[model samples]
Target: MTATQFRCLLACLPDPLTARVVRLQRYVLVSLDCTGCQEVGVLLKLALLSARAGDLPAAETVLHLAERTLRALAGHDHTFAPPRITRLHRPRPRPARSAAAPSPGPALAGQVARWTGTRPLVAATDASWKRGHGGMGFLTTDGRWGIGDWKVGPQDPTGPSKIIITELRAVQLLLSTVEARVEMTVLIDSLPALSYLWRWQSGDVSALPPGYEAPHLRLLARRVADRPRLRFQHVKGHSGHLLNEAADSLAAIARRRAPGFDVEARASDLVDSFLTSWNQQISA
Candidate 1:
């Protein structure tokens, strides 16, 4: 079938179901010679449906079979990008100044007074920074884990290198791994990350960090906003919280696995200056 015909077929399916299927089928049909090949087409669709329904392991197994089947029929190398888990991105908020601490308010005071609660689903998150790239991870009380790393793109030399971005990303990954609408407590050791979340939760956007990471922080806040019952808890690192220690270990591993490059050392100095000035101004 033509690409248009295949698209029309996918359009008839439900959105969530069609999205995953489209990822698999678009690559197979457009990149490979799969026109009029009913067997391979059926296998691709089955894999897509299974993955969309949360049977990811089964879908991967079937996809391997389909890959072999396609190679047997087409007699050439064929490949498709594996499906990626979707994260929520919505309700984008306006960016504020870089590393700007919110003016002293009752919300901040209240958070300090009322920061004692725990849930069964506990996620302890941490980040490790190198010169250019950084790694972050979150480990739950129940053994679920999410780990990842980010680095400045060689093409984007102006990117910020603050470690708080990695910390925020770890919280975002932890929240994404858990079910939505379920109450969960996230323990993070970064004071800046915790402060940012408290400010965002209080709807005080003016009191957000400044820099290239401001918009990304706003994005992370939007995800937290969706889960009204979610809570952020500050925990001291290296104080022997096993889950936090595990997350720290995972983050270190990810940092080791991250690609090494020449890090621009001046970024940290600049950020420190900003923080120092901001703190002085707040104190005055």
Candidate 2:
């Protein structure tokens, strides 16, 4: 998108904050001779820091600055390039380096908040153990987040097994702790949890493997699933998203779970998204 068109996208903002912020960014880029992608990468980080509050306008202005810098660098080569903003997985209101290590539970929540900037998000995640597996059901809302992570070790090794049971525990935590009567979205990386929500919502309780019980979530799903507002969305793991990255990093530190998520949702992704949107406009 051209600088002007990108500026127009800030219509989503509340007031003149977009203009003021954009002007600030332009001033910052006044110096610096752009060349390799290294310079663009640095500017992109500043933009991500600027976008921390979910201010789309501030983000756009920051983006416009990046674009202008790139155009100057690319010279005769296309002036308007796509924005490649990367996302970070940060705890909500990222704490100081000293507090970076949070108890697994709160640590995860903080990581999620830092990413999406939402205080509350439902999560369905599973952990693999030597015996079997464990799953967690967590909700972050209204500035407070809680989690119930349950792992099922090698047991009767029968129906439902550890994964299902652990997942059930997590789901219960979400329904029981969340006080809001309204539906909310949960971010999860587990397919089992997603299918579980779908099955319970659809009233296919029998779909669950034998010897297992959903307890409260099955009922909760029945009531909230149809609300159209309550739902869960899956974000690919290790996608370089700021919060996602932090979550994975912390999880790695905690569980030593290696072979991290594939897509590392970095700040560049956001920049890329901006550039793609910008390019579309320019080419259009």
Candidate 3:
């Protein structure tokens, strides 16, 4: 069947039935000897169709099958090669930075010298999403931290996009609490959030996804533009990074609506030890 016809048929069926059909089709396609380019195209369409039907497992299975089929076909047919199946969305090429763009390190140092006249503070930020609610947390080098939560709105993008939005919200919350004149280095785990910040820093405001007009995102762009002393660095999540782990735990606590703990609490003591060890390591 044509992809259009298959999609129309899937639209008519109930979700459970559609999922079963998707699984069955994946099995059948995997078993077939798909030698021709047209057959490979059909498999690609089927994979896309399965994904659109919300049968992600079946879609992944079909994609693997398609990849294997293409590889086998390539061994015999020199004219045809498989395309990269994993990269569903190719990123747009970024323009080169203009000569007027300020270097982050030197520019931040100059700003700090003119304003704060002290060393820049280091901070790590993290976010957690559960049950349509997002919690954000940030911990600074000075042993200060903050946690906040946001509810998912009807206007916000759902699914995977929501996590990216939440990550951005975490940054926005951090920016709101901190003084703009204070030179600070913010560490985040989300690449998409960092990408948006970097793009905004380069004066490219149109880099955000189409139809993604979150108010917090606009505010974040403006704040980042205004504060040239703010430097963003990426930290890998779930690693043994002390401040990141503490920030992550705080975010989880906020999201779960757990009991509040004072600075002398057990969690605080643990974080204090972490900070001490981190400081010792840095000084060493």
**What lDDT would each prediction earn against the true structure?**
0.55, 0.41, 0.59
TM-score of each: 0.51, 0.37, 0.52
* Regions of candidate 2 where Cα sits further than 4 Å from its true position: 1-141, 149-161, 210-228, 242-284
* Model 3 agreement with the true structure over 115-185: per-residue lDDT tens digits: 22224588788889877877776667766655556676676553457777767767765665567798899
User: Positional deviation of 279 in candidate 2, in angstroms?
Assistant: 25
Q: How do all the candidates rank in terms of TM-score, highest first? A: 3, 1, 2
Of the pair 1 and 3, which is ahead by lDDT?
3
lDDT tens per residue, model 1, 120-239: 666678998877767776655444555556665556422453687778778766764566776778888999889887777676644545555334455567656656777888989998
Query: Candidate 3, after superposition: displacement of residue 243 in Å?
Result: 1.7
Candidate 2, residues 184-284, lDDT tens digits: the string is: 76655557767776776666654554565434344445544544556766767666433333223322332332223212232123323433443355468
**Top candidate by lDDT:** 3
Model 2 Cα shift for residue 264 (angstroms): 26
- TM-score of candidate 3 versus the correct structure, residues matched by position: 0.52
Worst 10-residue lDDT window for candidate 2 reads: 104-113
